[model samples]
Target: MNLRRILAGGTATIFATTALVACSSSDSEDGEGPIRIGTTDASKSAWTVFEEQAEARDIDLEVVNFGDYSTPNQALSQDELDVNLFQHLKFLAEYNVGSDDDLTPVGASEIVPLALFWKDKDSLDGIEGESIALPNDPSNQGRAINVLVQAGLITLKTPGLITPTPADIDEEASKVSIIPVDAAQTTVAYGEGTPAIINNSFLDRAGIDPNTAVFEDDPESEEAEPYINVFVTKAEDAEDPRVAELVELWHSEEVQNAVATDSAGTSVPVERNAAELQEILDRLEEAERNA
Candidate 1:
């Protein structure tokens, strides 16, 4: 993917500071120390396979798990983690814009469809005037709204916005109202008989089969570009060969099998190069700034 030139000729400025820490894996000899990676899904079996694959290549890896979405980038920026692989470009754009950071994606990962689950309802029909549950976070909330729009349940005041929020909904024209809840609690709301937009991470933990979703957004659609997951590191470390190697390892057959299993066959693996990912991130960051 030529991750060595992630931001080469890109719009974002790269700082000239030295390494964040003296013992950073970037500075260490090959396999000298563990490359610390922050993720929200360390317990997923895919990560175990990823770790074993890294070991096979003499790349020591330490998987640091985070409980929430807010901390991984902070940990990476603070030099506590070498990289993070949890969020999509949209979420990362929001974080980068909000925090004024330039962490860059080194490779593209899979995109899992954000799906609607209902405990009682079998389809989108008969849900008029119903309260739908969605993740309260801006990124997921916006995507959830789009999912409803695609399902013919809602309409937006302004069509085609990348990160539309609940406020952007044309409530007068929409058939259903939204109830924003924590991402982890969407399953709870679903169990309570509310049709919820559940992210893949929370689906498996709650014992929900992703394939059983009543409705789901198409992962390969143009609107899904912002939702493509990625492996991100500080912009300064973008060119590290080891980082590229780690990204390549993630696509290995064994690791991808685990990923498919972990995501219950919902994950659509993507293969965008570093420059392509950076271009997407740049566009998202610009939209975030204007929004």
Candidate 2:
């Protein structure tokens, strides 16, 4: 996560611009200041519900949208955002490692599982030597490979390992040509040709039907752990009264129902205890260190 390099990368330029605006507006704890939140545009519904909840609590809520995955953590680290709700523990850990920032998750949100979609085929075996598009980001690229392994389309040297990369691809089946493209471009690639795996967000944005996806990430499996989006803030802010209040609100029945009905299953709020969330975060942090 070279912030400069990532910013220079066109994928997240919109997020960077929004972060600049947020930083400019966050000069004081003035009565006029809103609790600025950084998140991807795909999670618009959750942000709407969060804004409503914040308003009900008399807290001004400002929602900032990011185009790429890297900018939210960067914005949060720079205090441009009070919090972010776009990435999972794995991505957060990677951000922490790359930026040396101490951010912590306050609550878990949806599990937007990655799916392998193809316009021409129903199964991986059926489309041999087919061109596949995958997210170029390291975390997602590795996760997509794991999905391929899970589907028995390919095998990794170590199964059940977190963040396995292409270097770890052991059994290379001749039919599959795993191509790395920008995560945001995966859906577009599908329209142009066959894509082996596309992030759920990209697929949804492209209007691809999830039910018709050729291969989907197993939401119930450990491999999908890295894709579970969560609300995150500075570690020191994790226990702040306001943070706790918002986390509780996000998990409330009202918000849960809103997510289910409004998101059309794009987001699945985690219904885990505080202790369990901590355990998951801790495990993911450890995995990131090893990776």
Candidate 3:
């Protein structure tokens, strides 16, 4: 992770102009293949911006959309994709630790909030002793706890830790009991009348409106760095010139604007250099191992 903001004035306009020119004038450059990118529907529009921007650099950026979260990284690990742009640093670090993969981030993307969703209930005030459903995975469980603490439904004896467990819950002060289930199960888990903390990635499948979220994290805060999504590639390609250009274009006004509008203003764009990001990843991975 050696990311830096590609700060050049009028870069977005240049990218747009170059992309339009290349797309209309050329098919493929000598010794260059399409730069395949894998991501979810949430960021598809944002990638479209990157794809177009890549054209200006004579790189044919192809987007491979995945319906399930599990397959994108698997494909990337197997060389099925040149890069992937969906997972946050925590999820990616957890995946790398578990799979022994060396996939790494090259650019900071967006930070989507972990929201509390409930059907037939307007707010947390109406709920009580509810058997709340949340992610069972170590990385996200702690995030859910932080959201609960913010909502005043529970308290952590030691607050602000990136990874917290139910054992960390102050039960006597907790307004609701937690039912930890698999990450995908959280969507259906909410249907059973128990409010659940849902990751933004699964909101479409869960059919919940993000704006209606009863609680959310502060996307601009330092606490949100661990959750920022990123443009990632295998460790070996981290500094490939083409990858560098793609990452630079990602921070361009066009792509950043797409991220804001396409996510319906839910995901917040944040910038972090590689060294700073790696520091966060190291801490998260250590916590995952201990958990």
Output the TM-score of candidate 3: 0.73
Better of 2 and 3 by lDDT: 3
Each candidate's clash count: 0, 1, 0
- What do the candidate models score in CA lDDT, each in turn? 0.81, 0.68, 0.73
Off by over 4 Å in 1: 1-26, 29-34
Q: For model 1, what is the error of residue 150's alpha carbon versus the real structure, in angstroms, after optimal superposition?
A: 1.9
- Candidate 2: which stretches are off by over 4 Å? 1-36, 57-60, 64-71, 78-81, 120-131, 172-177, 192-195, 252-254, 257-264, 273-275
Estimate the overall C-alpha local distance difference test score of candidate 1: 0.81
lDDT of 3 by residue, 77-179 (tens): 7565677787888898889889988788888877888888887766778766888899998778888887787778887888777767899998988888899
Clashing residue pairs found in predicted model 1: none
Root-mean-square deviation of each candidate, in angstroms? 7.1, 6.2, 9.3
lDDT of 1 at 195: 90
Encode model 2's per-residue lDDT on 129-216: one tens digit a residue: 5667888788888888877777666666666778777677664643465788888888778888766587655555788776667777
Q: Give the number of the best model, judged by lDDT.
A: 1
Residue 284 lDDT, candidate 3, scale 0-100: 77
